[model samples]
Target chain A: MNLWLLAAAVLLVAAFGPALCVAAVAAPERRLIAQNLATVVGALAFLLMAQGYGRSPYRDAALVLAVLGPAGTLVYARFLGVLPSSRTVLYGAAIGVPAVVGPVCAAVGPGREMVKVLVIGALLVAGGTVTSVKGDRHG
Target chain B: MVSTVIVIALVLVGGAATAAVFNRDPTRQALVLSFLGLSLALLFMAVQAPDVALSQLAVGSAVTPLMILLAVRKVKRESTDQDGDESESP
Candidate 1:
């Protein structure tokens, strides 16, 4: 793939994914689904770039986003008291595992293929957000 | 030419779907908007952006519906008025 195209994809995913997710949650109706989907895709694109064509700087950037994105969302939701405190703790535990594992895998795995895993893992985290948020609101 | 036409058609369809959201009730609006996301992902794939397509699928298909359901639940809980009958005309 062309380097610039890869870069553009990464930028779009990173900038728009979380923003849309946050907006969807805040907005009424089914917008949350759109935002969540955008977030997952965006995170996945960044992950691909980080592994396939990105430099160390790109990898590092993805790492920061991976850690902070859900954390920030959880925090915002918590402050809003949308979910219970116990749920936040659970989210923390869920997020913490990959936060440690991704860097470790990147350090030791072949060709630092951790990026691909991390991207998918980030999608999983996004999934958790969906589940937890949905559970709290519904059940 | 065909590709250009397709792209234009996709954009138009996506735009119309989004605009339709405002006219519908919240639940319908949300569902339609999610379809918009699907359409957008397809468009990305059509343009040879598989990575983006995958991401869109992951988030759009999986995460978005749950979130919308949650929001809808919250609204329902807060409203405490189930009947679609309110009598204030302005």
Candidate 2:
């Protein structure tokens, strides 16, 4: 049994499943949070899958997700005109990204792949931060 | 083995799709739709189709939801504009 695959499976079943179920009935603000969190979970799962399959190219999917997930949230906030408040989401990323990506990086053992993982982690944090903040200032 | 992952993704996609149908609001439905997209992408990846998963991520995660929301916004604005002027009825 591959630990990475197990971790990814746990994430999909445990984290993403419940988050999505709740997001269904949650208020608009809560829905936004849930949706953004799902992106994080998805991206993280992709990272785990990459390691589990021993395919560096799999990480590219994670990278694309890291970049697009937050952008999608921001688009929701803009079009729907709602910005939910949640420090927990931020804190979760702050801790979760490093916690997951750090070990993966170390395990991959400093190299291009390690750097790619680190870059995806950074993108997740930065993109999450940018979207999680207050509503759009301009326009 | 991998089948477990595929099954989970399938279930989630089914749930999200049902939620999208039950939810009355276009905006919220869009959210569920986005979720469906995410799950579908996961399923694709699980099945060893990274290329399909990549395209799914782009369309499902952002583009699909954005199109729905934008359509909703446009409809609402047009309706409001019509409401502002009593002369135009319908």
Candidate 3:
């Protein structure tokens, strides 16, 4: 019941619940938006869980997700013939990733671990931007 | 707190799985299925199995949905080609 795990728990409940509801019931475009939201929240929660569990390897899941999540969205957009114009993932990458990654990086201080955290954060933001901007071209 | 996270993850997994089951449309079912994958990964993480979670994230979140969508697209394309009419039929 550490602070990090508590945060992860709250985030999972608050974000994932609503995202699932929308993804299940809404239109494809809206479902894509919710899926984007879920991925962002899931990544952040993974980061928090890594910190809580005191295991740097756990963060790899978040890193893999940072790469896969937006790509998954693009797959949906291409198949569904509609790209969501929502910038939720972009906003989460810019704002939420930093808010979660910064503290973890600081806690880890200067080291290979810190660099890994930074790289994952960069990937998250980059993936989000790609999904958000690419939609403008297609949508 | 770990127990609490686990319980929450379990509930999410249950909800997402149920949603996937109840959705009749294949495309929409694919969306819910992805959500189910995400939650299942979360559950695996909560239970201290990051390895499983990582693989689940790869397969569930991305691969499964992609496969379903591609299959649906192919089926619709072939059906429309056979009919030679695409006026929003089915």
Candidate 4:
């Protein structure tokens, strides 16, 4: 087993299973938060797997995830009519993505691949902020 | 080695699907379904198919849940409208 990829896979399963369980049972507003958290965790895991396997192409999936995760949350927030109302979770994710992605980019060194990693990190932070912000309508 | 990761993905997918099935409310089910889609993309990526994973992430996570929520809202609105009309008729 490739240890790093294995680690990523394990993290994914560990976090994802519980998050899904929580989303299934939690209240409406809380379920949305769990879903958003799962998206962030899943995106990070994808990036780790991409780095572990030395496959730049795999980052595309992560990139898609970083962009889409918040958009998905906002869609739910819109229809469900509830935003997170605080920035703690969002800020944590925004910080966490850069802390993880920066090291991976540095280890990979400067190149198109490093740039891609940075872009994904930036997108992840931006998306987290967008979704976590309190909206005009509070549900 | 590869199969181990694949097995993990399979387990996660199975668990998410089971949760989705048992949750039994369309709005909340939509959240579980979106998580299912995200993890499904992760599974595809783990099995060494980035192309498929990208497409799956693009459509499955965001679009599918939005569609489900919209459907739920429409059904809810229609039911409320029916309730409103019933009150008016008396």
| Tens-digit lDDT track of model 4 for A35-88 | 887888788888888887888787888888887888888888888878865455
Give every candidate's TM-score on chain A.
0.46, 0.91, 0.91, 0.85
Residue A33 lDDT (model 2) = 89
Could you report the DockQ of all the candidates, in the order they appear? 0.04, 0.73, 0.84, 0.76
lDDT of 3 by residue, A1-139 (tens): 4999999998898888999999989988899889988988899899999999999999999989988998898888888777766666668668988988899998889999999989888888877777765435453
TM-score of 2: 0.93
**Top of the candidates by DockQ:** 3
**Residue-level error in angstroms, candidate 3, position B35:** 0.7
lDDT of 2 at A31: 88
lDDT of 2 at A139: 20
The weakest ten consecutive residues by lDDT in model 3 chain A span: A130-139
Candidate 3 DockQ vs. native: 0.84
Looking only at chain B, model 4 earns a TM-score of 0.94
Error of 4 at B32 (Å): 0.5
Q: Residue A13 of candidate 2: its Cα lDDT?
A: 89
Q: What overall lDDT goes with each candidate model?
A: 0.46, 0.86, 0.89, 0.81
